[model samples]
Target: MFQPTGQKRLTNVSVIRYKRGRKRFEIACYPSTVLSYRAGHLKDLSEVLQVDEVFENVSKGKVAASGDLRECFGTTDRAKIIRQILERGELQVSERERQYGLRNSLQEIANIIAAKTVSRATQRPIPVGLVYKALQEAHFSVQPTRSVKAQALEAIRLLQQHSELDLERARMRLRVHVPAQHDAKRLQERLVQIETDAAKKAKRGEVGSAAQVAAGASVRGGSDTSASLQMVQVESEEWLTGGALLWTLQIDPGWFRTLEQIVAEETHGSGTVEVISLRVLHEGDHLNDVL
Candidate 1:
């Protein structure tokens, strides 16, 4: 052993091991970083590796022989060899770690849902616990490697069909055809202003009513805005012929009437608002039960 484990510190260390012939190469990596690196979300090696040095035996802190690097990679450069090891190595993830990751991802999906959705009747943001209960009831198979937003969308669909809880998505998905160029601009500005005001109120701890709290909630991965990134996100936008605009929006259900007013005012009652799907939320009592 080159050094005792007590003498070294590698917090949350996970090993990525590569083998060639009788020689085994290893790198100490950040446990949390391996999945992201493997998914290609992270490219920089420095961000992944805990220590730059390749190891013959990581637990013992024994460095690999220089000749082995040349034999395997045809180069003695430590950085290059480490890169190859990282690329080809099998990351060692235990069942426990995987379960932990699954839990975290499930919670994240629940959070995004809570932030974006509300009770159809009360128009209040659903508590995180209630979202989890719905997920559990729906038998959502939480996949840690999957996108949370995509999972959230799927969860909504599943909850509507299978779970006891119901949601209001029909009123939220609006297909609008603005008759003029300026009308689209006006509609976007009005919705943005509403979101900005709500987000500011949320930050200031002014959640006085159910509607207010729902409006104040943030869209975790839904909107592209810098500040509020609020509701009424543009799902699709296209400029139509003869100076008109067509749009598909995913918005807060609570804003349906306000949206109707905005659309009516902007297009002077000429634009069409198409509705897609609706699943009623009649679970305020259930939400309390879960909480």
Candidate 2:
């Protein structure tokens, strides 16, 4: 066990990049106490703490874990965060949710329940029995908790009302094929108008930003058609004499459905949006590159 020498306060926390391209994050405290995790675990840790990146202690002050964990310079917080991340990662959406699809709220709730269950469990390799016990204790109903599969499905259905976590996921790049009936000039005008409205929505705090709203529109079909928009840039536009015009949009997943809907509406049901590729955006993915 890693022991603490003196007081418990965040001393140093930094992300270590290895020569072979491996990365690790280490959180330290006064004296020599430290907690470390692999790069893959960083996402969950950051999500639990609501931080984007583990900064070097010199630039910004060291961040203590929230609540009780802040006072202790031990592995408790690190282990708990890692365990939750692992459990949530292990969860897979039910075949039914995959086939019939889950409502957005359900998906969010499912994620929360998974995180909470893993965090609450006392034993390692958290057993299905313990999961049921936790859910029952917390009054989180997952019908037929006898089996893991049944429990997961039930949890997804019942947990749709839990607290939300703002975590960034992968972004999808789309090729919106517009009908030839909409000329290049007309398409440009519509795109501009769409983005203009996005800016207005951002100014009103209806969305993350003008960019998020504009980009969200291209991916999800623009939920708030007149207001919300994501910050996405048109990668390229290719035109053929009589064929459809292919316009590429790179956007985050949060507004993907909205983007698809808006495009269909804009094209008057004549246009179609197809995902060309998906990628997780990194800090290096600058606005200029995306735009």
Clashing pairs in 1: 167-279, 170-277
lDDT of 2 by residue, 205-267 (tens): 686642444333333333332232344546666776686677777665445666676677777
For model 1, give the 10-residue run with minimal summed lDDT. Answer: 282-291
Clashes found in each candidate (C-alpha, N, C closer than 3 A): 2, 23
TM-score of candidate 1 to 2 decimals: 0.52
Question: For residues 1-291, could you state the per-residue lDDT of candidate 1 as single tens digits?
Answer: 565542343556889899999889889998788878877999999999888888887777777888888897788898888878787898777789878888888899888777666665465567789889889877799876579988987787577568766554422566778999888788777777866787678678885543344464334333344234355656567888887888766556656667777789889999878776432233545321111
User: Model-by-model lDDT, in order?
Assistant: 0.71, 0.43
RMSD of each: 14.0, 21.0
Off by over 4 Å in 1: 1-12, 19-23, 35-47, 120-123, 170-291
Top TM-score: which candidate number? 1
Q: Whole-model lDDT for model 1 versus the true structure?
A: 0.71
